[model samples]
Target: MLRIIFWKLGFEWAMLLRIIRPCSDQRVYYFAFGANLSPDILRLRRIGVYETFDHVLEDTVLNFSQRGFYKNHGFASADASVGDCVYGKMYLIRQSDAKRMDYFEGVPFLKAHAKIVQQVQGKPFYFYRSQIPLNGLKPTQQYLNYLTHAYRNMDIVPSQYTEALLATKVLKTLEPQDQTGVFVRHLSRWPKILHPSLKHYEKHCHQLVEALWNRSLVGWMIRV
Candidate 1:
């Protein structure tokens, strides 16, 4: 019951903010990888894209090292490596949208903002990196489907890279240790109640992290 109430409150609060939030004219370049590479996902997330270009990050490799919302799989993160490259779309988006993205990415917590300056243009473009990197992880097949869909639908990324991603191993089933996965799996028992409960729990976690970063002295120091 409390979860449902919190979920309702959070949903209402988000809607209110969207109604009153001022749009910023300032724009910045953002590098998209993993699930973010999908235009459909971007649209669903309500991230506006002014323009997009196929860009490559030199000396960086894509890896599934970031623990995902579900314990059974991991999410993509860019890791620095010699003689490696990560190819993806660079989007020009409003600065306001970028801040909104910070919440979704769990910035200053699960992930952190990172940038690379282009040698040719001398402009910095931003990307997200995992705060903690773990090895020997695989992404879920459903997550990989988003990347493959983007690769096929966008026709921007190289074919070889797409094939490489397709060849990557995926987790076939959720591990018993995956708490969120287990919660979701049992949703069929009471979807109307459990679904909102899960959503509220996620919203509360995000709020807690955001509040800690905004109010703590350590967070201030880190921001500085």
Candidate 2:
């Protein structure tokens, strides 16, 4: 009966623990493809990132979302499209720090939504993308400068990112989505077996695999 209820709720018992435990020694990896790539901006914003790295998430495209950028007349937010690849920085942050960063990025709020986790190497890395609702709008000079500056500094400029950005254009829309996210909107068909509930456990189910890796009996293989 307990298992049936958990299954019907489409979550595991572990979700309750996740709600209660906001702090953990296990830090998570976050990919920042947008303005958050700037270390100076990150510090100024005081996002509390534990450590940062330059990384390229393969097979994802980048484009602008959101209608405005701060005080600028037209500012676009960086969002990922499904097809191409995007270059950006990765931040290793604690659970608490991650929360602050997400809030600043409008996670679960604004046009941008919560992080959609992807894997790098072998661990989990959440991605944050912005959704822009207006069309024919361009980014302000200052906004472009921030992105270009960060790209050059991060070695992303020499790559195809700049050219790709030059080609991508915004589309016009009558109504804007409140916070319809990149990953969440399409997650209606996600694997039912992997959701979180109040007392469930597959995220922790792997015992022999991890133990084998630790004992040199097996190696860590990255699926992605």
Candidate 3:
């Protein structure tokens, strides 16, 4: 049946991606400003941290503009803004761990694989930015809680910065009949058939975005 063929194709594609995916053995500095800021969350994600430091990304402002898988909520994104800065912790992690992070971040799908680099204490640090950003989205309380815990745990200087994060507006409750959740739940029932199709769809989307992102005009528009 066509379903079986697609499933096989999808499985093979996934394997190919894993094989071709570039992974570095060396370590790199990753700047965390979102949920990854929480030590507990980082551990849960299985990213081994070698060291941590208080850092700031200059000429940027933290915004909840990145669309999340969960409807009605947004994830943290650092937008370019003159004379502004986003404070967070810098984590030194293995390159393999960074690849793991890409999976969780929905890289090449929800988020682009493009690295947003900035000078932190005279060294280059990397961070992520959403592939497509929308304005005026608020984070959920649960997401904010992770950030709250992180800010408390790390000694981010200029206490007011963390205070601003705490003050960010949050969606206190998710809808009882969250349609996305329902759809995902139903879709999970037939992973064997659906998984491949879903992966292909993600791959197609990533290719499309990458094409547009490579266009200078389109890329500039996306940043602004």
Candidate 4:
């Protein structure tokens, strides 16, 4: 319940910032990799996003093969040497909504960093890209530990409210294990390959990480 409250508050607070414009163009473009992929999730959240640019995370593959909502759908792996570019669907969101997306993704939750992109129409704009980081995996480790114990005795699916509670439990459980440095160091060994397709793998990786993190935690905390 606390997590849900936090998410609601977070969205409300972020929506307040939407009044301020990041670009004069009003509409902002973003690359969504997670719940945005699931129409059901969007309907649940009441977030209105429509496809604008059809994209794919060209070089990357699914990082977590299980426990995520979307993994059952067949997808390719992101290369260690060259990350895979998985297919992604793009949306033109209101600048206000775009800011909310950033707020939800940054820090405590998933981090979606902005990248400069040139659209098919030759318009230069910013889009959010997600990845493990140039230094290496992040939030993933903290996320992993939290998930390990949080879901140890729970059902695979639970009520939405219970799922939210699990999110909090996972975060609290992992706070003591903040090993950011180690994860970043590990990245040095990961393949730093790029894909040729217009798609960017980092964005997809971010979405995948976020979805898996939330769902896995939720699945582990609830009673079937």
Candidate number with greatest TM-score? 1
lDDT of 4 by residue, 1-224 (tens): 23334544565555544443334356766654433545454444334554465554444442322122121221112223355443345677666556555544542333223343545456444444433333222233343333333333334323452354344322122222222221133433555552211123333443445543323211222111
The regions of model 3 sitting more than 4 angstroms off are 1-25, 112-114, 121-123, 176-224
Off by over 4 Å in 1: 1-19, 109-120, 153-156, 176-224
Q: What TM-score does candidate 1 reach?
A: 0.66
Candidate 4 weakest ten by summed lDDT? 68-77
Candidate number achieving the greatest lDDT relative to the actual structure: 1
Q: Report model 3's TM-score to 2 decimal places.
A: 0.64
For residues 1-224, write the lDDT of model 1, one tens digit per residue: 34333433443343345435635467778888888887677765567788888777778888988765444467888888899887778888776666656655655224333434353256667887766666877898888888777776656567888898999999887643323321233555655756766755654553444343223211212110
- What's each prediction's clash count? 0, 15, 0, 26
For 1-224, candidate 2 gives per-residue lDDT tens digits of: 33223332322122233345546576889887666676676664444566787887766655453444222124443455566567778888666556545545544323344467888879898876554444445564545556666777776546566755655443333222222122233334556553442113322222221222112111111010
- Locate the minimum summed-lDDT window of 10 residues in model 3: 215-224
Model 1 local distance difference test score: 0.63
Per-prediction TM-score = 0.66, 0.54, 0.64, 0.40
**RMSD from true fold, candidate 4:** 15.5
